[model samples]
Target chain A: MLKTIKLGLIVTLLLPALTYAHGPARVKVIQDIEINAPVEKVWGIIQDFCSIKDWNPQVSACEITEGNANEPGAIRTITLENGQQLKEKLIKIIPEQNKIQYMLTEPNIKAFPINTHGSSIILTAIDGGKTKVEWKGNFYRSFPGPNPPPELSDEAGQEALSSFYIAGLENIKKLAE
Target chain B: MHFHNTVILFLALGTSLHVSAAPFAYITNQGSDDISVIDLAKKQVIKTIKAGHKPAGIAVSQADKRAYVSNPESKDISVIDTDINLVLKNIPVGNGPVGIAVSPDGLNTYVSDWYDHTVYILDNERLEITGQFSVGHSPSGLDLSPNGSKIYIANRDDNNLMIFDRHKLSLLATIHVGKAPFGVTVSRDGQLIFVANVQSGDISIIDGKTNKVINTVKTGLFPYAIAHDDSNNRIYVTNQRDNSVSVIDLDKCKVIKTIPVGEYPEGIDIDIARRQVYVVNWFDDNVSIINTDTLTVTGEIPTGSGSRAFGRFIQFSDLP
Candidate 1:
């Protein structure tokens, strides 16, 4: 008899299966890009909280709604070029790690996508002053029930956020570099 | 993070306990609409079982020597007799049936209908719908209490966990957790419930007795699913985007070690008797096996693309 299971991470039996979500909606969007600039240079541009407008062409105007700049509880409202208004609140700002956590909260704001409230942007330093910026968001579509409209479906929500992140990251990379 | 030498000692201790001369695992390939059965003893794929369209969730009944796979696209459950390794029938289920779980006794199976917001109960012997429970929006993960008297459903869209009385078939309580709670499992002792919030990248710990969320432990990005190992008192969480497993020491309530694995790691399970951890990487078309004691990747087995392997998936010894 062949004894295939060795003591270490039983390397042999890798069973593959898919189809678990119950047709659940795509509720998350995470994308990142590598930059040639230093971590400090990149962090300096984004850490300002309200500086998103200068780096993102989609963001037409940003106003500090509450608290001081870079504060964990500071609230800011960003108006997109399409006149969509998004209210965002800073959850935390860790300068040591060059990370910022924020959440979107408003009474009835339907700016970019539905339920795209919480987001995080982190900067990691690579070898020789290179930097990596990861912009991630956790959200769902406006329609929560079954058979969402094409614009508010899971694919639409993910597509909207993916495009937003790609555009924002591309512009930021060009400016930072 | 420094790993203790105690892991080596435990590994030496675990090697002697595995009773089976062979171990096997079944993975669901969504794109191919089939199940890939792997012979763990050989580290090779023994067979690919043809299944329905978009076969997704699978639950193995140790009591009955059968495997129930939920085919969302086909809207049916394929029951496989493990001894013969053959599909007996495709039991028609609700529309968009996704998450599936069998009672510990193997008498009943639960399948969550994604589009209907309900769970269908099937009798193991007859493969027929015996009962149904209306739940919240997008119930993804369905689990049972340690004693199998209670049911826990992780409602993905509602951001809540609905606890139900198994026999009574009535809603017990609903506890709000993090955003988009997807995967859920109850502790062995039935005291704790761990819900993986995909959107929040955290695990919400619910005290079963209180039906309240006691703590939320932050993990890596896009935590799709989790599995608990009682012997080590640790929970393994698969981070889809981070490509790592967040090992949380249950006692300390923190992520102790982040074990990196393949791309888009989704479904995860811990084989306690073997002291091994298995993760299905959705995009990588393979499963990464890790030695829990050493906290290292020990083996890799390739499978079909889009492997989700959502539920408990280890085939133990029925060897004579």
Candidate 2:
């Protein structure tokens, strides 16, 4: 319990510095996929904010740290396969629009190479009981200076986030279909 | 004879448009590296002009028929000929040129370098660097008084607004404001100055004569820039994080209403003649048009991707 408290203190101290540490330019990544199942099935697979661990193979585990799942202001800490953890907060969830919006509470450069990120997932019903899932992320590279190393560059951040979103969308398709 | 008549008609239409044209908003899209020229009457992107890398800040001068765009990543400024809707030149500036302002007479342009703690002055006619002066850390937004006597700059890192005498090139006063002040704007009559505080989520109103903050008005989350509607006695502030615009009633000196806009609205400007406010949304790549009289968002014009357009971007129709 003491170790956990220390870690929380460290995170609290580092929040402002990490949040403002971003490059001049912002990068956007959008990916979408059509599933064979209906909108309800697709929403069921990803509606819970903590369900990312079950759908995305890259996320090893997830735990709700604050508030409840699928509710605004809910916070979750997800551990990646590489052991890096990312804390995210749920911004909003619109059931009528089939949209879920969330943002990174604290950036983890080791896992995503991004300073700040806001992501949204939307479900659209098609004509033949099919659902289209669109996932989008707007973020900035973690490296604050110009000419960052390839690992921390904007391209790297974009590639990592697009792949992550695509992987989650593909997995959701598989589970829903 | 038919061709001659067609030419005559074309020339007459062009002359009329030149005499009475609707205002054009130059929206700088950082992601697309271009400016979406939106004709206010049409309420759509009429043209796309390529600018320097990562164009963010903009200032339009109707008197000179030119628009200046600050490209922070490129370390340069793009000069656009408003008549032809084309870039005339990309003048290299300081280390990171972000916030820019043009004089009321359209004779000079002031650019604030974010990385370098200095503001560079350019001769509008010759388009040459004429002067430079140092300022506080991380200067983000800047504006000139209507009479062109004073220049107000918001130094974001220092959390203060610096008022400079334009003629003497000297700092008149540095007023401490809320945390992370990003945009500085002056009223039409030059009676007050509004500084948008991003972190504090409020605006500090400074009296021009005293240079002292008289009132603090609360805004939405992360207010980035401000636009004054003098006729309505209100100011519109774009809240970047909230994706909304806060209308502050100057008479009451408080927030009157919050109007929802596009995602991540970063830049805001008012067209006084038409009584409309244009808000450029960075994330949604659109401009939300707010009817000033009604204080409602009436239309959304789709612009290029990552439309920041940070500074004063509207060219009023009445200007020479």
Candidate 3:
């Protein structure tokens, strides 16, 4: 019994030499809404990557840099109503598919809820001349560590994203109609 | 018959990862302020020890014989005696300590202050900040070379990997990686360094000798951390967006398999001896244990809510 105990102790000491417990970022929010407008009309309102400021009241203005307006590598510098700014690069633009994908070039503190992989605004045609627009995204909270601050926590970020998508979709419907 | 059972036990213990000689894995529950002690051989959580608030980063000093856990919200580091499984001390450091790494010699521990943008060096025995040095913004994931001569840090917001000298705490080099670079790891032989870029959904593999990104391998959405299997030259990356882990073959530089795990699998570690990988699911509030050989989840052990076992969390110890 003594020998067994000693051996167990030795084995235990050497076990966790390289074991690491590193958490990857979490929190994914995919919000979608049905817009009572034709798919073509809805896509027209949100098609231009820089035109986000026109329909989305949250964005104060947008400036396009590099490549054509619809090019995949086109960059957009957007300033929100709160003076918050972000640099985004257009990854893809599939007009036939009614899908536009853009990635966050700078996921800085100023870009809080947008610190994620590229978000897509996909418009799918419905049978009743309506469109199902998805303003979905995958992201980790701005604050990486546990017990995040109120504004940067996962819950707070999720709420902000949900509200942003809902507000944008609601306004787009009103404008498209 | 008694002697025969004892003999059988010893025989079983001789093989690595046998059911008889499995080690204890200490997992930190961020939301619950507790630690889950798991018996790998039994594939179950045997104990839950209370800890400080929001335990995030962790490291083990096998030589000093203690496990250090960084509680970012509490702004302190908790020291747990590996043999006794009790909190020995809670030493305060800079604000927002996220990533932690202990030196190979076990005399000093390095902690990254995420908010302060500095790395604090602590005296292992005294648990006092002996030194600190500034680095890039949002220093999150940190790892040390086995020789304890080099340090690597993932600057989350800066989108770069910063290398430092272990002794002088001097800036060595900064290599630009993918966006939202978080978890950083150095290979067993210190010839390779891997960084999980959360926003880019890819890994930047850096050559240890040149400190340059040799290759970028695409993974599932939001890969947070990675575990390297030295024997097979395979890397297991935990993807948060899709709730899966991508198994990458280093030799081939491609993801060969993607294993689905629980919801929001964040923190991940492996017991090389048992050939088992343990992942903490944030949303599911449990630990998913994977049989590395088969690349399958063989068991799911219930744990505290928001279980995030980050850093060197799984300590192989004798259950006390």
Identify the leading candidate in terms of TM-score: 2
Off by over 4 Å in 3: A1-177, B1-22, B317-320
* TM-scores for chain B, listed for all candidates: 0.92, 0.93, 0.91
> Which of the CAPRI classes, incorrect, acceptable, medium or high, describes model 3?
incorrect
Candidate 1 docking band: incorrect
lDDT of 1 by residue, B1-320 (tens): 01322353355346543333446788888767788887776666777888877687888878777789998767789988665566878999888788898998988999998878899999987778988989998788989997899999999878999999999999999999999888888888899999999878899999999999999999997797889999999999998767799999989999999998986688787778889888988666799999988999999999885787888777775633
lDDT of 1 by residue, A25-59 (tens): 22557889999999999988888899989888888
| First chain TM-score for all predictions | 0.81, 0.89, 0.80
Better of 1 and 3 by lDDT: 1
Tens-digit per-residue lDDT, B1-320, candidate 2: 33543454466456544443668899999989999988788887777999999998999987677899999888899998776566767999988888999999989999998767789999987878899999998788999999999999998888899989999999999999999898988998999999999878899999999999999999887898999988888899998877799999898988889999998899999888788899998889999999998889999999998999999898764433
lDDT (tens digit, per residue) of candidate 3 on B220-254: 87898888889878889998756789999999999
- Runs of candidate 2 exceeding 4 Å displacement: A1-21, A66-71, B1-20, B317-320
Quick one: best lDDT, which candidate?
A: 2
* C-alpha TM-score for every candidate: 0.67, 0.86, 0.67
Question: Considering lDDT, where higher is better, how would the candidates rank from best to worst?
Answer: 2, 1, 3
Error of 3 at B257 (Å): 1.0
| True-vs-predicted CA distance for residue B61, candidate 2, Å | 1.4
